[model samples]
Target: MSAQITLNARNLSRRLGRREVIRNISLQLKRGEVLGLLGPNGAGKSTTMQLLSGVLIPHAGQIEICGINLAQEPGRAKACIGYLPEHPPLYRDMRVDDFLLYAAKLHGVARSGLAEALAIAKSRCGLEDTGRKIIGTLSKGYQQRVGIAQAIIHNPDVVILDEPTVGLDPSQIRDIRALIRELGNAHSVILSTHLLGEVENICDRVEIMQRGQLIYGDTSVRMQSLGHQAGFIVTLQSPPEPAELYKVPGVVNVEALSATRFKILHSIDANTAEALLSLSAQQGWQAQQLTPLQGNLEDAFVHITQKQPNQHDQT
Candidate 1:
């Protein structure tokens, strides 16, 4: 791995009994970058995260963490990585302070720096005032904060979170996402999620995992542009014939929803809205409602996943 790269995995494959759940997953995470591992349920995202975090050994391939070969030096490599599995490894009976202190110690935070480590983790996760609270007594959101706190307690170079926002409410999800973004400022973070909004909002780049294969990898902005729906919906009070609407520049297709409403489709690179409005005004047709249609990330995600074949255990 290069000095700038926090994690590098080549052709990682893993098998659970007779099923090969992960296959040829080559991935790289640069320092201070947030990468989202996006896939549908049963897409092997959690399995892949386990492989990358050293929680499970790959059946094939190699992994490097901060230039240290994980297979050769698991301790040294894992020392630079912080991982929070899909179910956070939390002891419900422990107090917030106690659990975090234990986590820091497990990660080998020096005894001398343990206090500061716990304090920093708590502070970063917005858990400063919940130190004395019992882990089980806290709400779901606070428990999740504690989960994230433990992951970063040792201040590792890489932080891997599997479905961090899985069951949180809207408010909790927002808060957790903000914290993850903050972590990306200092450490390489890999977030595994099935939520498209999480990727669009939290990730810098996205790897679409399907059938244990990375079918697509790119910046979130580019990934979002995969399926482009270029068009506008307009409602005109006095509409002309469908042929008249077709005569508008850049207007390739027009669908009449009713006597007044229309769904106008244009070329991907066309500027039809302005021209359509102008034409409607000039023709004395009153335009009531005009709504621009945008290509949804959900549509793009489905499009990409459906186009790919099952890649696991193909040999």
Candidate 2:
């Protein structure tokens, strides 16, 4: 956790016609951190990203990139960010290299630095071989890499990806996840997606939003802890009388499933658990499994999002 803040939004708000799309929101992303933006559909995730990338001017808030105020110094601040929207902006007819060159030129890369710049971007995105291929000819996965290449060609301090793996296959998704992890090691990344697994796999921290408000924001580990309700399930080799198990002091509940298996839910600490195991061992009932169920990121997401009832009268 470095002291440098790559992106910060304070009291951010936006409106679409008469409807408020984003409310008072404050967020910050540290340098070299991957912050996952999570929400259900129409949760203002896209609008937030657009505002940060300078595509949409915020209604009433401040966006700062690497200490530069976006409102006051749009060019200097925006130059430090690379944004990939849900639909990547691509020139289908242009060759990959040509398109990248055009992007580089637009970003003001010097003529002498173009070759090395293209190579770095290509290598990082695994597009070295596809540089000469027409953008439309490549597969979706390759096209995505090209999109990323354009985003990072200028080596921006912050990279924002919106559903970077939306249309890729499972294998392609894995590859993109790896790329996102690698990107975070060098530059701060704000990964926006509704896919819970994507946040679990790559993001160090996550910010869950609902109805334009940030409901949860913390490290993945911390979020998991909030959802953890420690419990264990045990199966025995020999049928155990449910009533007998329930008699144990710390036994919270007992469920008998079949002739040889039952689950004993314990309501005690580790010491009490050991005693129960020993008792099971002496009774000649083979305890098949005793594993603690830890809290996970997915559980936290469900817990937070489900509580916010949708107010949309949208038909």
Candidate 3:
């Protein structure tokens, strides 16, 4: 069976003051999946998050949370969502336990269910030991944990976190990422951040925005595979002339990198590896390494976001 979709936004557009900030953005999140919203500063990633979480209504488009239309029934739609903004809604003077209880009440957790909800939220967020501590006295990491705990206090179906690890150190970031991964097992997560590494480590799928437009969206595996499909690096015990390698089917260009190593560029639909291996056997060229050039997420992000909108559409 297919996974259930917990959040959906279609043709979402938003404008701030006189400038259009989001343009025809559309995305979906499935239960048990983590979807990262990535973009540079001012790319509208945060804006998109606000739209999805019902914090900011869209100028044009529709949003649904667990099949409830956000525009038509905002309270019901929002009841299914938990949101943690970039700056967590934390009150420094309040005790962790008190703040969480307040949050639980605000989310409409029934009086009868508050105790159980608080316990579950605290346990899931690793706050079982710090409930008595004041929020201001805790480390940045713990503060973030408390922030997350409150968001999930009501056990919403979708969790939206915007820059959840912004000020965290390396260790804290790792812990938070692990927590996010764990959250994905039970909730659809939308992580909005400019940090590429965060997306690579925590997201099952990624959507990249540029100047308020979605430039690319795909599963993390497929996005990374795009680089390998573009070219290959071949090493042979006895080098063949570049022209001979280029003669292989679908091979567009071949460049000799060293005495025995060559780089081959190929057409999009070509299986360069298979063709090269066959040619190596036929020509008696002993193959040492036949590796596809794999592209990292950073490279893919740069290449896609750097293109002009019109140019991108043409390709």
The CA lDDT at 4 in model 3 is: 97
Candidate 1's TM-score: 0.91
Show pairs that collide, candidate 2: none
Error of 1 at 15 (Å): 1.7
Per-candidate alpha-carbon RMSD to the true structure: 2.8, 3.1, 3.1
Tell me each candidate's TM-score: 0.91, 0.91, 0.84
C-alpha positional error of residue 13 in candidate 1 after TM-score superposition, expressed in Å: 0.6
Candidate numbers sorted by TM-score from highest down: 2, 1, 3
Q: Clashes in candidate 1: how many?
A: 0
Model 3 spans with C-alpha error above 4 angstroms: 237-263, 267-286, 312-315
1-315: candidate 3 lDDT, tens digit per residue: 999999989999998888999999999889999999988999998889889989899999999899999999998888888999888999999999999999988888899999999999999888999999999999999999999998899999999999999999999899899999999999999999888788889899999888898988998877766544478888999877777887888888888889898888899898778988988888889998977777788777776777656686798
Which 10 residues in a row give candidate 1 its minimum summed lDDT?
Answer: 306-315
Backbone clashes per model, in order?
Answer: 0, 0, 0
By the TM-score metric, which is better: model 2 or model 3?
Answer: 2
